[model samples]
Target: MKKDDNAFGVEEAADSPGFLLWQVTSLWQREIRKALEKYDLTHSQFVLLASTMWLMQQGEPVTQILLSAHSKIDPMTTSTVLRTLQTKGLLERKEHTTDTRAKTVALTTTGEKLARQAIKTVEQFDTDFFQALGSKLGDFNKKLRLLLQQ
Candidate 1:
């Protein structure tokens, strides 16, 4: 175990920001998985559903491309998940009124109800998960936003 055998730039693994981010993301996702379990929703499902709900609330016509963009999910995966949701009767996809080539997405009554409930559950989970950051959470979020902008 010679020190020269490794290519790490940091003296300690914990000193690497990317490694720390990966650790935190994994832990956070695990908790989110548990929180969403009661609703029988996968993380991707919850994210797409919630994003659709939000866009609808904003009076935006939710199309598959828009949903994919809003959720930061790849278009193909988004389409597949949406198809599963449609089969489960949680949402519906119809030909867009104005765009013949696109499909619009909307939550059914049941889906809307479920989304509201799941949002509350997830939000509570987030509050608990990030509680350790306390007053620094806002700054942390701003940093994340800055990273996203890049």
Candidate 2:
């Protein structure tokens, strides 16, 4: 493949697919952060919470390790976030009945309530953010999935 080297001393950004992707992703994340500020949750926290809730619906006992895998979050960070969630009464951690080495995590009543609220907030943000794209949303998602696979 040919490279574009023009004005920038560094390799031209136009020639670098990763650089373009990073630029667009940074802009998207900035907007997402602004939309999430009112909920007092960071983007990663929201992802972990949403992932936990989704996996819980399957009725299997979910451990911190499982949550970390599902959310693609680092184990140490997952533990810290879970502790924070527990302190907020949004989740509970107790020794697993079958696995002494692991603990089960479940959403408390308050936690479930907050999850629902946060879900609504996120849904609204997504709907509004994608409104302009309309039918192109499917194509965008498809292209993103393809890029992710690469």
Candidate 3:
């Protein structure tokens, strides 16, 4: 009997765009994870924290629901992450002045410091990652934006 060639031998996967995308995403995520590990934050935590910090800097009183919408995070997960950040003294949650029932989030000094450092790391990683595409990055980003618009 002939050996199952595709099963045992390395096959050309040029046609597997989904697989390729998955592989690339995995690699990028791994690199980010490695970088963020030093800051004692997971990727989701960093994203939420950074987003909160940035939005807060614009002098807007932002709520958890608003953060969820902006960060594309689920409410429950955002709540959980915010709690963790609070415990770390990185963020604070207080009653929304205008909305008696809602809570507003603010980044503490520590959180702001961490976000600043993490931002440098993330920016460097993004620059290096996207540099491979050179001028093609704009086109690639545009295409991705188009797809995401759907």
Query: In model 2, what lDDT does residue 20 have?
Result: 79
- Candidate 1 error regions (>4 Å): 1-6
User: Candidate 2 on 30-113: residue-level lDDT in tens?
Assistant: 988987787677888778778788889999998999999888799999999999888877889999999999988998887777
Candidates arranged by lDDT, highest first: 1, 3, 2
In model 2, the clashing pairs are: 90-111
Indicate the worst ten consecutive residues by lDDT in candidate 1: 1-10
Deviation in Å, model 2, residue 66 alpha carbon: 1.3
Each candidate's number of clashing pairs is: 0, 1, 0
| Clashing residue pairs found in predicted model 3 | none
List TM-scores for all candidates, in order: 0.95, 0.82, 0.86
- Per-residue lDDT for 68-131 in model 3, tens only? 9998899999999999999999999999999998899999999999999999999999999889
Which residue runs does candidate 3 get wrong by more than 4 Å? 1-13
Q: Report the candidate with higher TM-score, 1 versus 2.
A: 1
